[model samples]
Target chain A: MKLRVKYSGQLRTATRCGEEDVGWSPDRTLAELIAHLAERHAAGRPHLLSDSGAIRPSLLIAINDAAVMANEANATRLRDGDVVWLLPPIAGG
Target chain B: MEDTGQRSELDAAERNRYEWQLWVPDFGEAGQRRLKEATVLVSRIGGVGGTAALQLAAAGIGKLILAHGGELRLNDLNRQLLMTTDWIGKPRVESARRRLRELNPHVEIETIEANIDEGNAADLIGRADLVVSAAPLFAERLAMNRAAVQLGKPLVDCAMYDLEGRLTTVLPGRTPCLACLYPEPPPHWKREFPVFSAVSSTVGSLAAMEAIKVLAGFGEPLASRLLVFDLRNPCFETLPLRRRPDCPVCGPISRPAP
Candidate 1:
């Protein structure tokens, strides 16, 4: 269950890699994936989390192409083949 | 059917002009007619807004009002489709008005050369049925949101940050207003961030499509959700958005007026 993860805009600069293929997991949540990626890749720890360890409002998390509540980052369950995308503030028209 | 001569010929011309849309059954006579009679305001001729304006013009929107200011620069060409090297240092709105007219003579191009501020937002937006908030910054988007709420007009707000774009439809109190989603304008540094034309155009086209849907009364409106497009990986996402009861712009309005 490999997942294709993508980062866009300035978030790319922070993540270091625009694209990543992550090992598959069953019932993994978005937060777990980001944490895993931070450790696997040379990417710096996600600044998406605020000092309080909450997802920052300035960024957005989407599974397969839909936005999800940040507080539910880890709550939004992911399936074996799901694709989750993370993007930090750049512009939204 | 004796008078069918002129009517039949007109239908052929119309079909030829709108052949692409005509293929969509729902967008037949009524939709095409509505599009022909609709007026949309693209508040800025910047990256996303400019591209949206161009699509509107090419798609045969009956009337388009482009509001923008300042002289063009070489840098603006990256996403500002409305200008060319030949028109550098010239006024944006004026040049865009001419180019759009060339694309489709039928599109009535109007221009408001001044910037949209709290002072003139109402008057600027009052002329159109719907507003497209593609302004360069959040302050402009916020001002347009207020004007739309006051008029009960729908606003297609698009913003770009690098290769990512976020689009939200604001119907006053129906969904979250710009202020509800963003309490403040995120500071002027938001502009300091780099933007690519590819991302700008992506957001711009989506904004135009939303405006078309609203004008013609077809399809589902992104009323209570935000559409996020990340060109870096080509992912599209929509998140349900709730109206902020305390939103400064439309929080306490008697009704959304949408």
Candidate 2:
């Protein structure tokens, strides 16, 4: 399956992947896709996941314009031509 | 001061003050009066909230409660337009009040030289017809969310970092609250982040518009939707937000006592 990933806020600079097209195997969870991306980009690994390999709480993942809750990301499956948004929370007022 | 709920008819001067906006279709003297009768609370008068408050005042909001602590610094000049150089060492709320009052003296302005917290969030939010949560900390945002939900007041959440900004409007039980989006503060979120004045102010102005629309029933607001703008990519996305059934703040409240 092919997916388009976009990073927002500091994640764009940290990941150096403003928007990219990636190929993934079928039936992979959103977490797996994140882990895959983290492995490929050394700079983005720490920003995308914690030491325990859990998705960072501050990062918001939206699949096709629907935000997936942190607790549900591990179980949410991805599909072909899906657009994933990696959004880090912007805390500044 | 509390809203006395007594609204006098719009005088000729008041009508002239909002002449341009009054011409907006479906938003005539009635909409202007609604603005004059509404009270809004803006948290942390920084880049985002300062712009939001300024727009609210310019639109003739009846009352504004500005909450923020600490003195302004020279570094805040880039985006915090409400702060003047002379007021650099003064409390942020004071600068915000000065600028906002100068824009529209008819709008009642109240200042709180303290940040929003669990202790005072309820009281501050309860007094307003709506809230604009532009605080830099999720702790403050969540506090405002809880208070706004409990009080059943509308809240406009605005945030910015780097060249990116996002805004969402919360309508208590009808829409998702801040807590519904992030059940807990993102562990990676820090107090300081990169931000441009343009981005923050852009989001701030949009937030003010959302609040005005909600308060005056002028247009369709972004209820239950998050609008994210990435100035770097120059892209804008509006994602639908869902209310969590298990949302601790807004969920399980059932209905307000009739």
Candidate 3:
């Protein structure tokens, strides 16, 4: 399955790209996808996940424009052609 | 929330000064009255809070409680609109108060020489009907959020990073608070981020408008929605938001019936 991944704020700074297309297994939970990206972007790994391998609570993961909260990321399943948006929390006034 | 019940009547000068906005179909005399009665607390009068307070004053808000601590530096001149070059070494909130007063003398402005923190957040938020959380740190924003949620007042959270800005309105029990959105501060998040004046001002102005809508009950507030815009790509998007049931801060507040 092919998915479109979008990045904004610090995530864009880390990933060095606004967006990209990724081919992944069907029906993988959002957490798995985040882990996959963590592996792909080795330098940005720490920014994506915590020491416990949990997607950092501050990183907002949205599947198709609906934000998945920290407690729900593992339960959120993605499929072919889905759009995932990763936004690191920005508090700049 | 109880503040709306006591909307102040607009005087002749106020009505004349706000004549154009009074022409707005649903936001006529009543909306103007509501704005006239509102007292909003804007945290850290920087790029975002300064602009938000300016807009609110121009829109005839009755009072503004400006809270920000620190001396303005040359670097802040790029985006902190309320500050003047001459006031570089002065307090930022006082600058904001002076600028806002110059713009709308009819609107009362109060300046606080401190930033929002867990200790003072509740005390400051306690005095206002609404809040604009524009502090440059997660700790400050979350502090304001906890106070606003506990106080049952509306909060408009605004943020900017480089060319991107985002905003959301929190209606306490009716919507998800900031804690629900970002359970914890981002690992690498820092106080400083790239900012363009235009981007911060844009988000600030929009946040002010959202505050107006929430106060006057005229337009649809960004309740349960996040509006994100990136000037680099020139795109805007609204993403749906949900309340986290386990959100410790707002979890105990029962939602009112529709």
Candidate 4:
């Protein structure tokens, strides 16, 4: 399946693009999606997941317009045509 | 005539002020009447605060107390709707009070011509059912949050930049306070940022809507969540937030509620 990923603010600068189309598998989650991109796009980047495979606090992840709470596993089981948005905690007034 | 709650007794003519809202499913004459009884304090009527306060007053939130210290300047007209070109040299609170009272005479308007701070935050927040943080600086924002937390008042924080806006509702100790989400004011958060009047209005309206929902028992109040908007790309997002264990104002204190 295919999933569309979106980015904004300062993260867009680092990702070097606002959005991308990526291949997906039903078995995967948001953490898997970013892992795939981080590996494919840029090597040596700090992994998004912890050693225990949890989303790191520095990065904020959203699935289909909802922010992931710290306690919840942001990596939900993926479905075809899912929309994902990634944004780091950027500072603003 | 029923008390309508506040001293501002609803006359036969003023009853028509809420005809549309009163006809809604759950918000009938009683709910509309409930709104007329609630009091909201808007801290520092500026870009975001002025717009939110205006909406609350126009929506007939019975009593509104506005706190703002600065005098209006030509530069403030960009996003401040309460100030007009004619009011440039006047104090901001005066213009904000005048515009708010003019919108609905039924709304009892109170003015606090002082900036909210650690010293006086509680007294101003004490009188209101809900509070709006429209003040520019985070020092003021932090003060408002602390006051709201101390009083256990639901706080609606409206903020905008460039063409984007973000809103979040703080349910005192139940949800995350401003300090939880932002541990401290960011170094880059300057007083003036790129903002459009429409964006400020948009955030302000949403803030007022949240206050309305909290006050009248309407829809979801966005409790414990942060709603961020990017009008440039028009993306609306909500992030679930939990109280930080070490947030200064909202952090862990080994004491119970006073």
- After superposition, which runs of candidate 4 have C-alpha atoms over 4 Å from their true positions? A1-93, B1-9, B251-258
For residues B1-258, what per-residue lDDT tens digits would candidate 4 score against the true structure?
134455545567677887777677876766667778888999878777888888888778888889888688998888789898999888898898888777888788888888889998998898888888887777888888888988888999887666656788988767778877655454434676667788888888899889988888878888877787887767887767666676777665333354
Clash count, one per candidate: 15, 1, 0, 1
lDDT of 1 by residue, B225-256 (tens): 88877676677867767555666778877653
lDDT digits (tens) for residues A1-93 of candidate 4? 988887654445457666888888888766667767767655213424445645555455567766554345444776777777765443222
DockQ, per model, reads: 0.24, 0.68, 0.84, 0.17
For residue B82, model 2's alpha carbon misses the true position, in angstroms, by 0.8
- Give the clashing residue pairs of candidate 3, or none: none
Question: Once superposed on the true structure, which residue ranges of model 3 sit more than 4 Å away at CA?
Answer: B1-7
User: What are the per-residue Cα lDDT tens digits for candidate 3 across A1-93?
Assistant: 899999888878888889999998876888888999989887667778898888787787788887777567788888899999988889999
Off by over 4 Å in 2: B1-6, B255-258
Q: What local distance difference test score does each model get?
A: 0.74, 0.87, 0.89, 0.74
B15 Cα displacement, candidate 1 (Å): 4.0
Q: What is the lDDT of residue B200 in candidate 1?
A: 87
Task: Evaluate residue B126 in candidate 4 and report its C-alpha lDDT on the 0 to 100 scale.
Answer: 87
RMSD for each of the candidates:
5.8, 2.7, 1.8, 5.7
